[model samples]
Target: MHGCFWHRHPGCPKATTPATRPEWWQRKFDGNVERDRQQMDRLIAAGWRVGIVWECALGRKADGALIDRVEAFIRHGRDLRAEWP
Candidate 1:
């Protein structure tokens, strides 16, 4: 999920909601999170393992580590939900 500020990414500096029409942004973010929740539930019901690789993980210093983490997730089959280091 290549989400933007719409998903309300926790602790990410880039995930700030729009300033204009704060109420509308809140409603939109609420809907976005709800949709993500429903989709995640369906995927879990289907026995699919899900992982969230945040966009912040793709940067100059962290990109290499992020790739390694992704490879480990695929190869080792471990449940992981990593955040900013």
Candidate 2:
């Protein structure tokens, strides 16, 4: 699972930048995003499905339904790419 802050999940409140070092943080986040994209691309090219499960989705109080969804994806999902809420 990827941390929402590090992966910069769109519209996620956890994806926040520190006020002290805006430029540095942006560069770091950008690098992380780029690396993730490149890795996913490579995996896709190798004929492997990819799924991103944000850390926030598996909260401290994770439920059975969410676990089932993840399990289902791993077992039978056909999509090349998917992101969990």
Cα deviation at 33, candidate 2, in Å, is 0.4
Model 1 lDDT per residue over 2-76, tens place: 455766777778889777999998998899889987887788688776777666666667477777877777688
lDDT of 2 by residue, 1-85 (tens): 8999999998999999999989999999999999999999999999999989997888678678888987888899988988888
**Clash-forming residue pairs, model 1:** none
Each prediction's total of clashing residue pairs, residues at least 3 apart in sequence or on different chains, is 0, 0
Candidate 1, residue 23: CA error in Å?
Answer: 0.6
Per-residue error (Å), model 1, residue 46? 0.2
Q: Tell me the spans in candidate 2 whose CA falls farther than 4 Å from its real position.
A: none
